[model samples]
Target: MRNFNKNALNGKRAIITGGGGLLGPHHAIALVEAGASVTLVDINEKGLKRAKTKILKVNDSAKIATQILDITNLNAVEKFEALQTKHDTNFDILINNAAVNPKMSEIGGQNSGRIEDYNLNQWNNEINVGLTGAFICSRVFGSRMAEKNKGVIINISSDLAVRAPDQRVYSPSESFDDIKSYKPLGYSVVKTALIGMTRYLAEYWGHKNVRVNALLPGGVFNKQPEELVRNVSKRTLLGRWANLNEYEDAIVFLASDSSAYMTGQSLIMDGGRSVV
Candidate 1:
């Protein structure tokens, strides 16, 4: 039997969308540490800088690049792809990890949590960033990968993609009248849509050696309110939220040849939350 190569992605290149968000940098870190050159694309310049800083701290020699662009804009994405091709920097992996996750605490108003009162603009904005952005990036990057007859696309979905959010966790009291916070409907809808896209792309590019998959992660602990933490912990089988770095290895696995046979699948690493 041939031994597996530890540096499986030594010369591989990757592009990560929403590269400046909470999990984006960590995803970059995982790919960087695994020997892949990573380009992080995001609209927020500061977040991109911060993500680069965090990755540099982990490995100063890490091959990391950042770009400011809106993934929802197809023309912008196409232009970026053209520029990358000009520089001979074709990507071997694409991680569609961008999304807008609205916090209940940050939103305010009498009916903020009510679906009937959800702002149309907010709904459009969230879907544009979360679902549409994924579609755009996959089209721009995955197409090139298909032409080359090799690549991987990992959509960063959520555990909620498989299961509906238990809105009761966001409420302060058991009474329905006292409930003032509920998870946004767009979040679940967008995440679920990603799964469908993953399947479609997987088959579309399967003959060309391009593999597509989705990563369904659970909530990460980021200093949430005590009550909220407690409520979520009680429901999770692991009795706690995942650590920020917990998904790093999984990201590397999906990116590298280690998962060569895996395609058109959803890798749920939610501490068994979806099962329970």
Candidate 2:
């Protein structure tokens, strides 16, 4: 309870993308508990229902709303602006948590035999969801923040953006390949680019007191079927995948006043996977 008071997010208005995903649901709860009104955005109706239900069970009266729309649709984004105006609440924090991968992993290089099926077309499809979706979210939300010179934009990224990847999933793996790791063409590339965009927006808007940053969360471990999360724990220095709860503190830090003066930096929460 003491921790809650030290850095609470009381009375803030937040918009979260990907709120239906594994990490997004938990993130939404934490924000609401901190006294913020949260708007959960996702394309999955079922996930949205589950997310909203869980939040209400905790508080039974949390000010939470869910918006179902395809982020890829620019028209929908325009409408989002209108909805915000109607509510008379300018977004105080924007979390770009929604993303999609068209065909699993991305494969690159000459020996890209595994992800051959994962071509540029498939790559772009994932990029549109994984990266471009966040791009537009940030574009509209950050633009609003610019008008007031105050807001926080937290972008969720994966460690694969900086670490070596398992190429076997997307492409082929040589028996004796020293590099061992294979990079996906779409997710890794787009996520890496996302960090760049975060930095650019941070620098561009820092003068106005708007903080733009990225949260490169390590692989999220949940009930979802993920071979990477299941099998890769042995490779981690901690020997365990990060629980979904591990992300809450990082969220509070970035969304609360604690991270004031920080911008354009990535708060990576991987459990030593990148270190090794």
The most accurate candidate by lDDT is: 1
lDDT of 1 by residue, 216-250 (tens): 99999988888888888988899999999999888
lDDT of prediction 1 = 0.89
Q: Which ten residues in a row have the lowest lDDT in candidate 2?
A: 167-176
List the candidates' TM-scores in order: 0.96, 0.86
Candidate 2 TM-score over all chains jointly: 0.86
Q: Identify the candidate with maximal TM-score.
A: 1
**Residue-level lDDT tens digits of model 2 in 1-276:** 214543288889999988987778778877887888899989999999999998899778789999897887778986897778777788999998887642223323443434645466657777898788888888888888888888999988878777756543322332335432344567777778889988999999989888988888776555433554455675678877788778877887888888898999988778887887
Model 1 regions more than 4 Å off: 1-6
Off by over 4 Å in 2: 1-7, 101-113, 168-183, 223-230
